[model samples]
Target: MTDDAMLTSKHALVTGGGTGIGLAIARALANEGAKVTITGRGQDVLDAVSGAGIHGAAMDVRDEASVNDTVANAISARGPVQICVPNAGIAEGHSVHKTNLSFWRNIMATNLDGAFLTIKACLPGMRDTDWGRVIAISSIAGLRGLPGAAAYSASKHGLIGLIRSLSEEYMGQPYTFNALCPGYVDTPIVDRNQDTIAQRTGMTKENARQLMIDANRHKRLIDADEVAAAALWLVGPGSHSINGQAIQIAGGQTA
Candidate 1:
């Protein structure tokens, strides 16, 4: 296909596509002519975003059965999934002293295990095709430790590790695997985090929010489309050789 319709016959599956960064990427892929299946646990949220070239499915990435069933349904509806974005994840900051097994498990389940399941289910279809892309939405914490967010940081770190291993596993193949590590994106997750930060640190909500904004090198939250733009680049032209990379979206050096 031409660059104008590079994804004309492709099918893309994005988890947590109902809102935030995932939704932005779904829209971007659809805009490029790929049939997109945006999945979330809430059917209403998914349906609300379904239109144009984007469809919605209710699937919990934490469940193996749900992941498999949802991927099957997407294939039945839009053909093989040439693009997969495991963008669904939860972000919360907790000190190591306060982190428990349940908290650790939950973060790992949604962020790490979820990516594993999503990629495992989608790889077969991708392997059958001539070209495919797997883009995992990791975080800046994955590369550097974020104060008071030990569990969240660990989960994201594991995600990048998974992406790196897969990229090597398929080194000579047509499929490419990469992770996006963005700092303090402007999303619903950030809104919730601000509230948590306020409660935990006794800062006002606005101050808590500003804390994240200040974390970025540019002193602002990153737009969701900026992350989507990176994903589009990985799946778009000139990306075949850009595998196994953690593309940082922060304004400047994080470490």
Candidate 2:
């Protein structure tokens, strides 16, 4: 296949694809000729973004039935989903001492459990195909501690663990499993987090936002398209050997 039609016969499913990085990745895949299904909790948001080869499905990854039904419907409409992006997640900072069970479980349900359910639901169809990719949108916190966000860090860490183990399990198969660990991406999540950080630390919203930017090694927020480029590379030609890896898109060393 040529660069422009690399995914001509493929069907891709992206969770939380209404906006931000997920939307960016979905658009990139659709542009490359993949029939992309963008799923989110809101039908209107997904419908508004749907166009060309892009389709929309309302799905809540936190629920197993929702994941299964959405994936099945997407497969029926666009053929088996050869590309799966478990990109739906929640990011928040809470000191371990102050993090209650509700906060911790909610984070886990959305970030960790959601990835697990999405992958499990999509894998059977992927295995039926000759080419497949599972890209989990993780975070730098998965690689190391994120200070006050202990629960969020642990959920992301678990997500990476799931991807690693799945990669190992299907090592000899055509399928590839990997996680994209990005730091402070320029997304709506960052905007909401600015307010949270400002309230929590008594810093101005601008300072709070800049603090996250400064957290990146290159001292800037990573762009959504940059992460989408990495996803395209992973699913395209010459990436068969790149399995079980946590590719960091943090602009520099995150260790």
Candidate 3:
């Protein structure tokens, strides 16, 4: 089938979809003729940004019951979710030693446990369907040690593990599992993090911004649309052969 034909009847769900990369992906899929559901804890943001068949739902991915219910509700309205993007996560750094129980658990709950539940809840429906995709949004830190972000790195690494294992379990199926590792996307998350970066590095706000810019090998902040495009490609016709892979959208630094 053609790429466009493959995506025409799909239902895609993007977690943390109120804004930033998640919203970008949701809209992109909807544009490609898929029913897209954007989930976030903030109903206001979701409502403000939704359009056409891009629906919004309030969901807290950290809660297991909420994850299950949200997935069930989405399926009830739009049939099975053929594309599941577990993008809801909290990204911040605390040294493993300095990370308290709440801090550590919070990261694990949203990043790791949330991904597990999101994928798990969606799988039964996917198994009943003919084709599906599970794409987890991870980070460059998931592949390597982040000096001050041990907890975040560990959580992301766990997400990667989840995708890898699922890919193996359904090896011969039409479903594929993958991870998107992005570095320093231009988003609200970065805006909130700039202050922390400035305070920690004793640098001006602009300098803190430059630090992240230079971290990307291409010397620019990744556009949210760029990541969305990669996701679109994965769910398209030619990408069925790609599975259990990390498609790094961080210019070249992640390679």
Candidate 4:
């Protein structure tokens, strides 16, 4: 089959698909002829990207009811979700001594719990299909302990653990579970973090941004499309054996 028709008649659901890495992955799947459903907390944000083979649904991944209802609606409208991308998450830096209970919970709720709820809601539909892909957008922090962002790192690490476990649970099945761990991808989250890091460290925004770029071995910020390309590959043909792997999209080796 042609690249454009590879995913024809398939359905994809991507959370936080309004912007950044999520948006990139959603667009790639749509371009491959999948009926894509993009969800986020803001209806306006989702609506802005709806069309051209993509649909929009307003749903908060942190809420179980919202995830359940939104996934059901998407399945009803476009058929089973053969491609599930739980790309909704928040990135924040907080030292353990300064991290309050609410702050840690908030990070887990959005990053870890959000992915769990989204995957859980999408799994039933995926199981009904002969083939399915679960691509969880994790971070480099998931592999290594990121100083000054204990809670954020923990949440991401938890995501990798969840993906690994699910991969074993569905072993021999037609579905695969994997996590994409990227370092400092150019996204709205990174843009916001630049300001936050500058304020926290009393450094210039340029210097703060440079710190992130320096973290990657390549000394440059990664493009969101680079991560999107990996997601597209995971869902494409010949990826059936690539399961339970933490594929790092960082500029180079993280450790």
Off by over 4 Å in 1: 1-4
CA lDDT scores, all candidates in order: 0.94, 0.93, 0.89, 0.93
- The digit string of per-residue lDDT tens for model 1 on 71-100 reads 999999899999999999999877899989
What TM-score goes with each of the models?
0.98, 0.97, 0.96, 0.98
For every model in order, what is the number of clashing pairs?
A: 0, 0, 0, 0
For residue 70, give model 2's deviation from the true position in Å.
0.8
The collision pairs in model 3 are none
Stretches off by above 4 angstroms in model 4 are: 1-4
Task: Give the per-residue lDDT of model 4 (tens digit) for 1-255.
Answer: 355588999999999999999999999998889999999999999898888899999998889999999999999999999899999998998889999999999999999999999999989988887999999999999999999999999999999999999999999999999999999999989889999999998999999999999999899999999999999899888999999999998888995
Q: Report the error of model 4 at residue 34, Å.
A: 0.6
lDDT for residue 232 in candidate 3, whole number 0-100: 90
Q: TM-score for model 2?
A: 0.97
> Model 4, residue 95: what's the lDDT?
85
